[model samples]
Target chain A: MVIKRKVAVVGAGMTLFRRRMLETGKELCFEAASMALESAGISMRDVDAVVLGSAPDAFDGVHMKGEYLLDGAGGVGKPYTRVFVGGGTGVFAPIAGWWHVASGLFDTCLVVCEEKMSSLHPHPQYAFWGIFDHTLERPLGVNLLWIFALEMRRYMHVYGISEEEIAHVAVKNKRNALDHPCAQLAAKITVEDVMRSEPIVWPIKRLDSSPPSDGAAAVVLASEDTARRICKEPVWIDGVGWSIDSAYWTDRELAYPAYLAEAARMAYRMAGIEEPRREIDVAEVYDPFSYKELHHLEGLGLADKGKAAEMTVAGVTARDGDMPVNPSGGLLGVGNPIAAAGMMKVCEVFWQLSGNAGKRQVKKDVRTGLAQAWGDLMQFSSVIIMRS
Target chain B: MKEGVVKKGQDIGVGRGIEPNPVGSKYAGIEVKESDLRDGRYMSIRYSAMFRYRWDTGIAVGRFLEGLRDGRIVGSRCNVCKRILVPPRVFCELDFAQIDDWVYVYDTGRVNTYSISYIDKQARRMSSPVIVAVVELDGASQGMGIMHLLGEVRPEDVYVGMRVKAVWRSREERKGAITDIVYFKPL
Candidate 1:
């Protein structure tokens, strides 16, 4: 892939993840976008274009959430675009901003992702019912937990992986979140706690999942010239890749995420990374569920198939380990605001690369890192590789 | 004296200026308690979608539904792949070719995977849990499964490969839908 102009992330900012925020989605976007602009030492007047990402309008009870959030994202008169790929929208937003800068069409772009899950009635999980097949699956009175529980069960059944092994991911990530100011469920809990928690669905204890949250995150992307001129330590976007699998998720093997592997391979190839495990310093793989972190790690080629749990048990994925994963605690601890959660991963990688992550910084001097997010009926994945 | 003091534009909109919000202390959002929403401390408007519409099940699933009404499970086969798809499709996803034939699959199938859901569709905790499973029917292609409920088996007794047969509802209660069969019970 020949490049027109290199794109780099100059600044990143995010709001604290919470269960119920009085602020509207537009307000959340404004807070995040303003902080990002301030961190970049630039004003909204300097922004050439804007890219916004938010998950389902059903959650916000507002249709056309992107257009509703445009002004808050500093997109009043500039070229604006809204990109949503389910939960992958957060990372996909930056990938869109990368396009505007890398195409030489815009010198500076502001990327913002926001989600207000609290506005939905009954419960946020209720909104997911619309995602299923109304005829084939909905008639079964399906709940979202059924799919994740089934997937987690299949992954365990296939690899002979025990629920105890998966519980360690939640324990590790929650403990790691203690230093995060924006963390929602950060804690120091044992695997026994996870095992003893109420079973929302068999094989899926309450503690094994991230809580629904309301938050927003933003990052500023600039061209090579703009990055060098304005910021001292801009994180260059080394590679970006996204892919979607067949929509019929039930027909595919639940134990492995083939779509994520295809996306990771595309990114690794573009970044010229032959050995992901050895070359990449850290990763913030999506972990909406504890098993998902392991699932995604295997899919990203950071660990061998079905061996991620074993690696986690061996202290290989700890913040102090050789390859730290989710050093910012991840969605499991920070919270899952859908689109914002994915964007938070990208912001974490940017912060980690710039050495701006204060107490959440890993032990190693990381030069290169990767951030990945999965969404859309267990079918879509977006990957971004960055280097300081 | 108070009536004679007519000073215009002297403190008009003075204190409504924007206050600088420090990143660490006072962030942008306000956290409201759930009770606040209930007590009407914050104004909220209720809106419900009136999306009443019919969805065309199309030829493949349309025929499949008709077959279910007649006490038979129908599937379409792509001769290129030589596999019958349950919840049949008109076009082969992999082969990208038109289906060659439609076949009748068995009412009995093995459980591919199952979940004991403690919550209902509205995310409300249920008094009795529902046992949902992906049953890979016999006479269908390998790994092709349909999601349905399980009955006549203890949740603790359910296993991954348990063979189960559909327990059809009464003929008078039968609707040309996937729910025509009440639930799958242990064979």
Candidate 2:
């Protein structure tokens, strides 16, 4: 083992995820940061550094999104860094905070992620067009869903999976979301409902996808000594890992996410979790699309390849199941605001490990949990393991 | 630091800070319906990114475009990996070596995967669905695909591994761009 300094998430908070929020991006950051500080029983004076995570600057129509969101993130004068890994930024921001504490450079760090996708005109989805390659992919006039659909198709063809099997994820996640106060698309829909929904791209229905939302999530990370002094029970970030693959997404195999697997391996190795399925009590895998939840679970080594869907179908991934996943309703039900969605997973895991997750809490005692997020043209993954 | 505001150090509380009685009980954030924006109830400013510049296509892509203008799909081959990178690159990401050998790939290819896109890049509904496919061009490394539009085929008719050929515009209409090859049609 590396025998590094311990770091823990002392407090966590988030605003409601919605299609459009009246609060400006800065206000949203402030509100979430305030709630997190209050939860930790601390004030701005206690924070030694600040880290902000947000998606594309174009989404907010701002040139410098990090600097623009500085004051609200409690980073006005403190040592600050803005981290972005597309949607993976949520966990990545906290990981940056972990470095601040773990590096013994700061006693306490505040990590905040905010995304106001509604600011972009002609729908927030339009902002993603810039993510594709300008020379080859952009000239084809591509939509984001088209690529996801292509990936989903490849996964299905390889595994002999059916759309019905994937629809079950949407059904389960939406139902689980009903208990979440911050959820935007909570419902009691069935697989048939998902199958009948409007198809944005073939193999991907409207119900199978998360909504474009404007929201923010935050967490306060503290050094072990500071955590012991301030919080009664802190969720320790036992492991943190992130990896990014090639930008030539077309050349890679869409059937599996090799980058996410590499990231998960890195996290598991640090956490000393050789058997993720047995050791991990709960997980919040990214579910931007219904199939992605299964895809990520497989990538995280929480389930066997081509078997995550079976776990969902068999109730092994339910709220009360053996290895509960997405007890926060995930991005599919809760709403995805790019970077904030990943941060929301980190917050959910913190709450889960600390026994703070209320109705959405898993049935069994959860001592260890993981939050993983994928982003940037299906090429990036960030994982954080938390233990109480 | 605001004008006329009392400094915390000069306050009567001194070392003991005043108690904060936070008021609102609800979670943070105020939700607004889309109608509010249309009605102008909540103020908003319409802004667009004003700055724009042309990207230099660079050495590898510059030649690739030249090849397309001449009715050919050019790729660069890495001697170390022996892999022909489509939509050519000056360097091989895997081998970490510069690639100078330019290979002309067959215009025909097989569809690796595809989608019937009912929405455009702006998420706007299109009158007719645009069929998009990742075509792995022949003579290039296996799985070395480039994203392009699929045409002259129905959405239901498209399948993985479907052989297709590029439908290029006439010589006069040719421009040194990806659009010169309009779409790929089933052979």
Which tens-of-lDDT digit does each residue in A1-388 have in candidate 2? 4535899899999998999887789999998999999999999999999999999988887879999999898998899999989889888999999988898899999999999999888898888988887776788888899999999998888787889989888888888899888889999998999999988988888998999999999999999999999999999999888999888888889988989989988888988899998999999999999999989998998888888888888889999899988988999899998889999999999888888888988899999999998888889999999999
Q: TM-score for each prediction?
A: 0.95, 0.95
Candidate 2 docking class: medium
Interface RMSD of 2: 1.1
Q: What TM-score does candidate 1 reach?
A: 0.95
Per-residue accuracy of model 2 over B8-41 as CA lDDT, tens digit each: 6774442211222224434776678878778766
What is model 2's DockQ versus the real complex?
A: 0.62
Candidate 1 DockQ, CA atoms: 0.64
lDDT of 1 by residue, B69-117 (tens): 8999999999898988988989998899998599999999998888889
- Write down the worst ten-residue block by lDDT for model 2 chain A: A1-10
Candidate 1's displacement at residue B43, Å, is 3.9
